[model samples]
Every structure is written in structure tokens, then in C-alpha cells.
Target: MKNKEFIFLMILAAFLSATESYALDIEFSGSRHTVIKDKPEASTGLNDVFTIYDIKEVSFISIGNIIAPSDFRVLIYSNLGGGYAIEQPVSITGTTAFIHNPKGDMGYIVEDGDNRYCFWVVDYAGKHFDISSIEAYPEQDCDMTKITVIGSGDQIRYYSVSGRQCTLSRNIELSYNTLEWDNENNSYSLVEKTAGFEYLQTPLTLRPPFYCNTTVTVSGDRFLKTWGLGKTLESSIIEANGIDVNTEAVQTNLAPDDASNMIKSDGTMLGGSAPADFTFYAYVTDAVLHNEWQIADDPEFEYVRYRFNERDLTYTFDQEGKFYVRFIGSNADGSCEATGETYEIGIGASDLRIPNVFSPDGDGVNDTWKVGYRSLVEFKCWIFDRNGHQLFYFDRPELGWDGKHHGKTVSPGVYYYVIEAKGADGKKYKKGGDINILRYRKIGNSSGASGE
Candidate 1:
């Protein structure tokens, strides 16, 4: 959502002057248990199909019945329609109902003919549903006037039911409508009012982890269920590393590393190790401290970081937007407050930190640049080339490093890798997973490689 907002593709917003939206006339009775059609005089019996449209709102009530009391349920649907993905299901309450992404999903429920009373109110546009395979569904012999369309779309199709030929299409939005399921004392309609809430989504700056395939929660949404860096730092900042960081991101210095974790709805918390070498902290204020604060020059994350209290005070978030990032440097000699560069993003605070770097000079320190899930429950790692070729694949963290092929060391010049580890729980399904990879420096043969 950085530059573009998510919009529902289904549109006819002002098809014929927004003011002249169509309306639906509704009537219901408790005794008959079916919607009463005084205006449209439609008859929806055991099996009948029709198309409905131009409907704005309807009001009525139905009586008790064996199935759905002539309310919303107890109805059949052949071809259903609504807005774009907005029609996604939030949750389900029926059995044997699984949702498939591209294959499409359909649902069906039967009324055991038991006396029951139930009614429900649903949002028309923002969301919709499909119901089929019912006793009356696809049965065209019932009645036709009982069903009609309330929207316009060639998308309306039909469903052939065993021993029945009734088919109906339901597609409408932005308005309220009502109908009955049966002809008993039950009648239905929409007449009450409800409340609505709105929110403004904020843009997130963190890129998908470069480690490998795994999930990371950004802002509040979880992304990159499995990831690993594949492209060189010079290629698209949005390589296999996940998410996207600008190519201009600093390499001389890295962004401060500060990642926090929250428990998912299932009580799964991703407690993984952060790059052990980098130090990052954040604080915020209103005024930009260009003079007092000396943040890192061309910080990788592009956020201002100043030194203070002898500690690395570079990535402090300016919550209040007040002011206060002073550069401070420390050496083997001593540490003191110093002015750092002054960098800025957005109004308050923002930036990502790349605490992990590979330059594994034979210094024998920070030696292994690899993904770790010591805390994540189930782990799966993948190594890929810049062209998306899968290389080394591991299922555990302890199995990292050694940087060898079948039996020899693999040449190194920034090979691409991704990880698909599972932490928290429900792994095989990809959850609290994160990605990271190994960076090795191939010098001498297995000998000098020491414990080579």
C-alpha cells in the first residue's frame, strides 16, 4: 500500500446517477415461514430460480419454520457475486468447508426440517457469500418470481442440481434487502441500522528478511512466510531478501537492528536472535535536531540516528516529534556524547536496520553469516542463486554453515539464499517463520580453512 491503495475491482458506482439506486420491496409472515411478496409477488417454492437486481433496501419479518424460519438461511444460491476480494471470508462455522485460493470455494448446508428460528444481517458490498447444493437449490420447478437480481453483471451464471433445474444469482452492494426462505409464517426483510468503523492503514518500511522463507509480522500483518536473499545487493532492492529496500540503502554503515515480537492469536511468539554485532536504539521529538544530532551518514535504513549517553542512540523513534538525537562515538579509548548525522523520514520516525553483513574476512569473528531459529520450533532453510535456483536446503538451525557442496567448499561471491523455517506452531502451514542465510569466505583448501 505504499503508492497505491487496495480498491475493489467490482464497480458500477455511478452507473445511472448514484442518487437513483434501486430498491427492494419485502414482506414476510411468521405462519407461512416464507417471504411474502405483495409488491413483486414472487413465489419461491421448494425449487425455483430467478435473478435479482437494482435493489437498495428491504424490510420485513418471517415466522418460525423447520429450517431457517423463512429468514436469510433456508435459501438456495446457484451463481453468487459480490465485490472483489472484499468478499473474502473472515471465518467459517460449518464442517467440511475449506477455502482454496485460486480454485474457488463453495458451501452447502441442509435444513433437517427441525423447528428453528434464526435471522442474520450481512453487509452487501464489503463482503458476500455463496451457498449451493441445498434441497431446493438448482430446482427450477418451485417458483421463478420469488428470485431476482439486484445488481448488473454478466458474471451471473447457473448451477445444475441433481434432479433439479433451479438457478439463481445474488449480486448487490451498498444497499439493504430482505427476503424469506419458505412460504410458512416466516417473512424477512432488512429494516434496522448498524454501526460502522474505519481505519487508515500506515505504510511499513521493513523489507522481508534476507535470511530465507519465513513469516515476519510487519506493522500488524504477517508477510514473507518463507524467504532468503537471492539477488546481489546491486540488483533490485526487492530481491529474494523480501519486501523491498531502496538500492541507495547505505552499505558503508548498516541501519540499527531493533526487532520486537508479539504473540500471534495462537499464542505463538517468534523469539529469534538478532544480529549480535549491531547496536540500535531510538527516541523521538518534534523539531529536527540537525545541529545537535549527528546520525550515521547515509544510514542503511535512512532514519536519523544520533549518539547519546555513550551508547548507540541512532535508531530512536521520535514518538512526540519533539527533538533530541545527538551523535556520540566510542573507541577503545573511551565513550562520550557526540553529534551524529541528521537523517529524516516521514514526519515522526521510520527506517530498517541491516545488522547482518557477510564481509567474512578471515578475522575468525562474526564468521558465520547464517539464518538461525534456535527459538523457532520447526525450521527449514533454503539457499537459492540469483536466478532462483535452489542450492542448500536445511531443516534445522544447528545444520548451518560448513559452506561446502556435496563434500567441498562452494565458491563464494555473494550467493543468494532464502529460509522457510517454522516457529510458534502450525508450521507445515508456514507461520512465525523467518529467513536468513550463510556468508562464507573461501581462502585456502580444507586445511587452512582450519577445523577447516
Candidate 2:
């Protein structure tokens, strides 16, 4: 019984050891170029594909650490057809394999039973390319700019033109394998790498124009490799001659009133009492052919009230209506225009008054004890019983408390209210007073005031 248990334990240990040593590795010789090993993407049945650049031919290839060497076969795939015949290695010695002067631009796969290992060979000799010059010029008809790149290469792998606010890039599709080896058919087959997606071939001379001063970069690739990994021969920084207009309008004066606790304006939007002076300044880019500050009654600028041709304007808004202000800037030819965001400026008379009593008798006339307010920015009100227990609180003047506590009607009595408020017109308020709650009872079709 002990011998039988020992034999079973030995067999289990050997099985785990063999499973751990099943990983295979391949090596290449007679290649002075660098090797790039790319792992397969997620859910792609493809294996790691090795890439070698600037090599005309590989002298020999070796597969090491291979288990069951007879079951492994090195197959070189043709790049022309999908169902073409596969080529075999010239010789195989132990775990090493060799091919006689293997051609470039071909994919090879090592079949180890059901597993497949893929690799690519690229002959990049005398295939170098460089950019001679990059020139930028404005169009004759409009303000659109155009860039032209002069280079000598098989294909442009990637190019980008970047500016202060915009960037345009064009890249080639080379990282993915659209055709994978099929074991059953002994040929290459088309496979969808991603669902509902197909690779797009980038054009060589698809250079788009830039709006501002930009930097231009370009690279070229002659063999199959990922974009941007190729050598970039030249990069140029260009200054645009055409105008790219950008404008901003901001309020400069942000002083609060001294007599009241008025919140300071952030210059984006201003409101408050009448006779307010608001100073607006413009921050613009590029050469301005014509610029103006306009004030309108509507947001769409259908009725423009005033127009100032200066870069800055300081106007006193004494009216009692909401106004909109914006700045517009244009280029010399008016082909390019830029407009700042419209700012809403409200100028209204400040008024806030609280009622002494309110009757929430479900009559909808004086149901809530809201205050009569106009342009009141900040407000807070608190209601308490005679014993100083807080019953209701509100921050906006538009909201009022009904004569109820804890979701039930309170007893008819006098309640105290405390208020702390600040108006948009820089007026501070701190007032408290008695609030009388009256309940009316209908008797014989006649309403009579009962609790007060």
C-alpha cells in the first residue's frame, strides 16, 4: 500500500513539472536590426508576433524550449492570397529550424499542436525617407490655411499639425492583423478583430490647415509596424499668417457697497440697484480689423441699444430692465470673426417688505407668508414660537412658511420671525417682527374669523 501511494505521488509531480515547462521560445540569427515583440490584444486568438526591421534576410531561425519537437512545424505564409499554400522550413535540427534566404514582407507561424506562434519579417534596406521642407500658406479666397509637406518615402506613417487650441493628425493602420492563419484549411483567413469595425487606409497627402501658429511633425514607414514607432526625420514649427481671432469680455470693477453686505460680483454677471457703473474690458487675440462693444435688450441682439467702437467701455446702467452685453471682433477681411459670450446685467430697484400677518385658510389668497421683494439676492428667514423653538426656516424670499409645524396646523397665536437679508442693490436688512396666524371657520355659509 505504501509503494502504490508513492508511485501515485511521483506521477502527479511529474505531470505538473511537464505542464510548467510547456512554454516555447523562438530566436532569430543574422539580423542586425532591432526586434519588436507585440503581444496579442484581448479576445484575439492571435499570438505574439515578432517584428524585425532593416533586415534584408534572416540567416537562420531557432525554436527553443519546445516540447514534442516532432509535432511543431514552422509555416511561412504568403502575403498575396488568403487561401494560398503555406511554405515549410528548409531544415530542422533538434529544436532549431532554418529557412534558405527567407524573403521579407511575410508572416511565419509555428504550429505546436493546437497553439500558434506568429512572427513577421520586414526588409527595410534602402527604404529610408525624409521630409525636405514643410510650407504653410493662406488660401486666396478665404482665411483657411494650407500646409504642404515635401518628402521621399514609400508611405507616410503618421503626421500631425498642432496649434495652441487645435490639432490634426493622420495615422496609418498597421498594428492589427486582419488576416490570421487557419489551421484547418492550412491557409490565411480573414477575421474580424473588433465587432462592427473595419480598418481605414489613411491617405498620404491628407494635410489639413491649421488656425494658429503650429508645429508640424511627420514620420515614414516602409514595413509593417505600429504607427509613431517609426523614425521621424523632420519636424518644423510654423507661424501662421492668417488671423485666428479669440476674444473675451470681463467686468473690471467689483466693488461692493459700503453701507450694505452686498456680495462682490465675479465680472461674469452683474445685478443690483440702478445707477450702477460697470466697466468692461476686452481681451482679444490676433490683429483686429474692427471691434465693438454692444448692449442689447434681448439675448439674440435683435434690438441693439448701444454700440461702442472702443476696446473697453464703462457705461452706467440706470434703467430698470435686464440687459445683455457682448464684444465682437473680426479680422481684416472679415472672413474670420470671434464673439465673446453675452453677459446678463440686471438693473432693478431694490425693494423687500414683509407682511405682518398671513391667513393660510386654504383660500389661496394669502396662503404663504412670502415677502414682497424685487432684486433681493441673499435672504434668510426663521420662524419660532413664543418659547423660541424653531418651527420654519427659509433662505429665499420667494419661499414662505405656512401656519403649520411638524406637518400639522399650529394653534392660532402670534409667532416671531427673524430675518437677515442682503439685496442685489447693496442693501442690508436685519429685521424681526410678530406674525399673527388667523384661522377662519365657516358657520351657516358665512365665514367668521375665529383664532387670531
Find the candidate with the highest TM-score and give its number: 2
How far in Å is the alpha carbon of 426 misplaced in model 2? Answer: 22
What C-alpha lDDT values do all the predictions have? 0.26, 0.54
Candidate 1: tens digits of C-alpha lDDT, residues 106-215: 21121223321111121122222221111111212111201122212222223322112222322111111222122252222223211111111111112111211222
Q: Residue by residue across 263-340, what tens digits does model 2's lDDT show?
A: 334555675544456777665543456788889999999999999997778887755678999888776767666677
Top candidate on lDDT is: 2
Backbone clash tally (model 1): 85
| Lowest summed lDDT window (length 10), candidate 1 | 217-226
Error of 2 at 340 (Å): 2.0
Candidate 2 local lDDT, residue 415: 92
Q: How many angstroms is residue 60 displaced in model 1 relative to the true structure, after the best TM-score fit?
A: 99
TM-score of each: 0.18, 0.52
Q: Give the TM-score comparing model 1 with the true structure, all chains together.
A: 0.18
Stretches off by above 4 angstroms in model 1 are 1-356, 359-362, 425-442, 447-452
